[model samples]
Target: MNLWTVQTLVPLPVLVPLFAAGLALALHRHERAQRFISVAALSVAVAAAAGLVVAAHDGPVVNDLGGWAAPVGVNLVADPLAALMLLISSIMLLCVLLYSMAQGIADGDGRTVPAARGAEELRRTLQAQDADADESGRRDVLPVAIFHPTFLILAAGVADAFLAGDLFNLYVGFEILLAASYVLLTLGGTSERIRAGSVYVVVALLSSIVFLLAVGLVYAATGTVNMAQLAERLPDIDPGVRLGIQTMLLLAFGIKAAIFPLSAWLPDSYPTAPAPVTAVFAGLLTKVGVYAILRTQTMLFPHDEKLEAVLLVLALATMLVGILGAVAQDDVKRLLSFTLVSHIGYMIFGVALATEASTAAAIFYVVHHITVQTALFLVVGLIERRAGTTSLERLGGLATMAPGLAVLFFVPAMNLAGIPPLSGFLGKVGLLEAGVVDGSVLAWILVVGSVVTSLLTLYAVIRAWNKAFWQPCPDERSLPARAPIPLGMIGPTAALVAVGVSLTVLAGPLWKYAERAAVMVMDGSTYVEAVFPDGAPRGTGESNEVQDETEGSTP
Candidate 1:
């Protein structure tokens, strides 16, 4: 009954997956063992995150590492916003892992005879594929040996990023996920993955460098990287310098989040990876960047109205440009990728408004998008599995061949398009409501852009639906003959779709939670109090009384 009493489970979500990653590495050769570790680790993570979400609904719970308070040592925070994201992410990660395990039956069958057709057939069946060619579709592909551990590491990174109470730790979390992601992106090291990996690595490293520099400047200006401490100091810093720091940070995060001006790299790199990898990336990675922007911008610089104007303009541009690109694409994955970029504008719109209603709606929208978008990508993966190609020009007639696949695709597709009675529609409505609630000139402009983008998104999804499932398969001889989807793949996709539907079903409770989270972001004193029992203790060089909440030191 007392959610606030559940304060100490914060770090377990981050730590368990890390420990599991190591265990998974030790058992990589045993695919069955790896599956057990992956599932168990993620299942525990989801439990931890869910408990935290229930607890965070009351307020934030700070778990100071070594029992040391902020501005001195690390702390894991489970604010409503962070906990909500973590819960959703953990659930998605678990489902995707199951999907990967089922789809990833790696290495050949249990027989070993050099050049034997059975072994060779098994190898080709599990061989990782390079999706570089536009028309060339899905294939049996990539290293299952390393998948479990690498994926678990990525999961840890995601948890770390959400739970981190300071900027440096957040950056570390981003790096953790990024490093693991490099392996996933290039799974099985196909030529296409190699080329795609190169571009991804270069862009990611460059963004990290910018983020590092921004952190340095923020420290130089404010003398602390703790978000709560920065909140108190940022108001006093020179406006020009603060603005500069904000721009640099946003540019870096924007690039990572694939916000319009800096979004070109995404469609190119994401579509080249294997479907599951692409699904997870599409689902989680960019959102981390959006989460960062949400955290830093709202928590650090909440009052700068001038900066708000700039963000509003960028939001409008991001929405319009991104959807327009989506409309122009002939490939389903690329179209989805572009739509992903466009929707970030909606979140940014809420961020720009800086009002409680707007922020809450934005937070709610993020959760909805994460679920729907991920489910859609998972369905796309299934499509490739059944049809062999993602190219709209090369795909069709699946409505009959795999009616189940069509239903799986249809729900998320409608949700993504903001069709009525779907989570997508509710999310867009919330954002629109936020914009209307704001009623400023720029907010109104963003409102128009948001609506148009949604309409365009529906068009794009319909186009994809028509080409991929409704229409007859083009060049039937080009693809390997029709095959039934694995229960593993279909089951996970269905689970996620159900999860997305649940968002609409539970929209009221979820929105209420988002409201609670937005309040925490707006008022930093509560967090400061929660983390450090004593008031503002930055640069004191003396240990303030850290809240004795967590179980112990993190390994």
Candidate 2:
């Protein structure tokens, strides 16, 4: 219970953001104050997560809430997997916040406008003003104030989900982020955004209900929602019921992760949001679902060949279907969104293989994808800003006109396509190698599917690059050169692009850490022992027995 211990750091990622969100909301009228609050909070979170990553190298760091122990009171656990995710996500969140702030998003009410119209004009107008409208649009400024607080809340929600020790807490975490996403997605009240937000809301709500039902079933069956306890109790439940619960959970998370067949909503939903919002969503949200699947599959139900086989099939379909969607897209944002869906399959593939090596590869891939995907979306945002449109046909000669932007787009694009020595390639290589080790007929099939997906992904992104930067503008009059791209905006995008590269530079250590984390994940005892060093109480509801420690209070 020391103030500076790793246990104490477990909840900071969640608490700091929630506390800052309240402060940010209070100071919303002062955009500078809001920005400072958000930046400082996320910075602190990033630092805390880094500490946890090192501390958790020893084992999972558990913080029991109100000094209550596990199987009763809720706790936050930062194991290697959770800490790794927290660190990467916090970094991404901080970078995107800086990018949005630089883009002058805080000064403007969210609204769509033609690129030829200066950003200054769009920033000052929320809706069409009446003839008697005053020169200073005070109403417009108030709407822009919502961004900081909501974004912080979203950050906290993601952290909470990552560190959540119990199924109910995980569900709560998903709802927190999803609710904030609803607002962010529909910020401008544009018809398209509103329509897309509606669909998103419905789908998210449906998934939440399914997840809740799964949690309820879990509690009923095992009499405990804490994951550490569930890991011990789940195998003891009826196989049929366990299978049903597992399927329901997968179905819920699959929808969120945008695994194909359940992914139709994503391309439609994400492209409608503002660039920063879309970038963050593309980077973090779906991976959260994938993280959940990884956690539950490895921890709660290890060595389930049936589920693994089904997952492999879904993984192949997701990769092929998603890339095909991307190949057909004309708009840069939509194409990136589809690629986002497609790359998720790689992570799923790593998970379904369910070996220590494959799990490690999945972890590495998630880190790589989160950084690379967010960078790509942010680049697309820049493309939209410069050209006034993201339509591939309308964009051209950007390699000459904005050589910096072209380089910015190309690095992450190739990295995403799994080019050599890049983090993306390293991550993919890890996965493909793991699949080969497995040597099953299905694994071999997925190996082939994965390579095909990578090639097609490269083609999809290169096609986008060729059309947007290489080809001549379809109509010369459509694009008017704009003012110099802001340094603030370029700084964060470049920083993220740099992080993606750094992942490659750091891949040796990263891969080793992922391998260690995977060993911890594949061996559930590492997590269960960390949460409850002594054997945990095994029981159903009030019928269960409890043991007391000298300082412990029973639930």
Candidate 3:
């Protein structure tokens, strides 16, 4: 019952950001205050999530909202998995915020204009966009005030999704994040961004509709939407009905996760956003979808061989197709977007295997990919600032001009390619080892596809590096005049790159923690008991530690 226990930390990740968003919005005229609030809020979230990661090692830490019990009241549950995700996501959010603030400073107050455009040109562009909007009956261009608040909302939504104790709450979290994302995706209100955001909004709406319909069907069929309750109830439902619900959930999450065939929207959508927005979206948004699938598959419907087989095949296709697309890309942002899609297949491969080792590998891969991919995107932003374009054909001699940028780009690039001893290599090795342990025909095929995908990913990034950094600039006059790179932007990006490498140095403990988290996920009883101990709803405002005390007192 102590106020300072880990349970107290559970909601801060969600609540702090939501509250900060309000403050940031209120103080939008004070850019300094807004930046401080955003950074401080996310910093607190990161610290709280770190605390949960340590405390949750013993078991789950639950906080029933308003003293209400599970299956009735909204609650937050921070097991090792959710805690780890929260920590990583908070870190990414914080780093990207710094990068964006720096970018805003360079672009005149909080505006996010292209570096190539002069002040007069940017003013004209905004005026033109506004004029076009008025004629078309569209919303006018948003001012700089909207960015921080919306970003905080995004952070809150991600936290809520990770800690959600029930399916409906998870759906709410998804909607919250998606709504913020649509705003962020269309930040500049440019015609290109509008086109990309339009496609993104349509696709996201479709996914939400399907997810909501599935939730309704699930409630109708099972009488409860709490994930712990569903875990117990799903096995008893008609197998056909269970499968139908399962397929629906997968379809919705698959589109969000950008699994092959469902992934066409990503490359086009992500590349059009501003760099910081793209970095966060690339790193965290799709991973949230992956987390949803992992949670439902392991807890609600474990060991369905048929479903696992299908996932494995899809994993293979996602890998091969994504990499092939990456190989064909000429733009740096689009290339990274494709590789992002391809690497997701590796995570899916691990999830399909569904063993402790495989699941653990999937968790590790998610963490590795989040840091490395985000760092890579941030570096690309730097490249664009330096060269005025992301076109591979036009970029060259960056290595000679900005050696620091070259290093920043190279470390993550090689890691993404799965070079030896890096976190990427370690994650891929873990997944491959799990596949070998599986030893089925489809598993072996996935193993081969993964290897080929890794190789192709290496080829794609290397080609990008050679062209962007090493090759000659075809038209030197087309390049922007070199301004000193802002330390604010470079600092956060370098910090992310270092964190990516740290994943390698700290692999031993991180991997073990992942294994423990995987065990908790695979064992539904652990989660169910944490939520409803002794087969009864918990008392109002009760924490998991209190439940343990009550259990001990029962004689």
Candidate 4:
């Protein structure tokens, strides 16, 4: 591509949604216009993401803002991994938009008659009362609405996070997304949602603070906040100082990723959001954490072998504990949220391995998990809508009533469980192969953990299927009548399922791209060069003094 075209490509993915969000806010009075703008923006973003991926096949695409060169101005670098993530985020956003549209249409239809009757009753009641207590007094009693322009703004924030070139910019992007999420999470202000969102907000804010501190320290130490420059300079930094900065960054991202010990907040917060919001969060947020961790480990501290054992142990623990949590949850959304935490361990396992093959596997797993996880959550949403509850006790005979939804749920559920001919299976196989190739005790532990987690995941999915679909509906006559599934809802659900199936069918090319992405990440020279054409000053590998001291003195 020409330079102008290359420059325009990176920004389009972010700008399209951002402009759409602005338009959506302006047109909020007209919900139809807002929906059209949101969908159109996401569609354009998806197309841009696909183009970026295709362009990245040849090499990385670096877009410098304001025509300034890297190391002087910010650069948006689109490597294969970044492109793949953008693609996954686009797909999930598209599905969420469709689902939300369906929900809005359904609510509008069902609420109109009741709303009119209620208004009439209120008018008559007011007419019999004092003239001073008029319609204005009751205007404040309007029902809370969920679907809004804020959701589109949230989408823009996520896109910005994926495409950001500098640490400070990433932080800004994260804050935007987090603020939007807080609103989305607590929408309608139900007691449970408020309680959950309060905890989520505190935890997320704490993590953001930690990240801010790391960014400040890194900039102070290295005189730059650009990730690519840091990668170039970090290796040459004082080992002690380097270790401390790296550890802080990792810790902050770990909290975000919900890695084992820090993961408690995710399960508590995620299931409380609206279905589309929950689906998007389950698919994108934690993975962003993983992306940060991947960047830190591979780019900034590649030679820090001291943390390898700790990462391995934590990965194992995370997997086991998360899967166990999944087993214990009776609610479909909560179960899936816990499972999301468990799967992050698998990604961390690959990062700890720090080999090209392992990283490739991690990349593959990330893509596969995003699609499967989001689709599963959407399916859970469908189940809740149809059955009027997501509790295992309340859901059943979906296979009989909604065969289409059953197929939609079953395919992704089985794939997530690592069934054959699916992308999940391919991902697990790739991870296992990487572990076996490494041939170390840690690798063996990871391999075993992968297998056990897969089995537990399988069990959890099967249990959900049995309780929610296979078994007879309890008190069938008493249960609510089955509602017709909206076309808007089915449209997105079908799109995501199709994407997952396509991933399975096209595993070869996709895996190759992932492998290439992994190789690119493992060898940081290309990325460094892309950011700093004339070669920036290198770090002295002694940046984090305290961490180095701890590592040096540790038994």
C-alpha TM-score for every candidate = 0.90, 0.94, 0.92, 0.90
lDDT tens digits by residue: candidate 1, 191-273: 77699899998999989999899999988887788877777778777889999999899988888888878888888888877
Write down the worst ten-residue block by lDDT for model 3.
112-121
Error of 3 at 92 (Å): 0.6
Model 3 misplacement above 4 A:
1-4, 110-142, 480-483, 536-555
Ranking by lDDT: 3, 2, 1, 4
| Candidate 4 lDDT score at position 65 | 79
**TM-score leader:** 2
**What lDDT, from 0 to 1, does candidate 4 have?**
0.80
Q: Indicate the TM-score of model 2.
A: 0.94
- Give the alpha carbon lDDT tens digit for every residue of 1-555 in model 3: 343577889999999999999999898767789889999999999999999999889788889988898888998999999999999999999999999888778766455443322234345655654565556676353465679999999999999999999989999999999999999988767788899999999999999999999999998887778888788778878899999999999999999999989999999999988888999999999999999999999999899999999999999999999999999999999999999999999999999999999999999999999999999999998988777678898889999989999999999999999999999999999999999999999999999999999999999999999999889766777665544568888999999999999999999999999999999999978888888886743222234458789889999
Please tell me which model should have the higher TM-score, number 2 or number 3.
Answer: 2
lDDT tens per residue, model 4, 369-486: 8998999888777776677677887788889988998999999999998999789999889889988998989889889989999999999999999999888888966555444556
- What's the true lDDT of residue 443 in model 3? 95
lDDT of all predictions: 0.81, 0.88, 0.90, 0.80
What are the per-residue Cα lDDT tens digits for candidate 2 across 1-555? 343587889999999999999998887667778888989999999999999999988788999998999977999999899999999999999999988887774334322121212343343343343222457744334444678888999999999999999999999999999899998988767688899999999999999999999999999988989999998888888999999999999999999999978999999999988888999999999999999999999999898999999999999999999999999999888899999999999999999999999999999999999999999988887887777678887889898889999999999999999999899999998899999999999999999999999999999999999988999766766664444566877899999999999999999999999998999989988888888989876765544543334226744
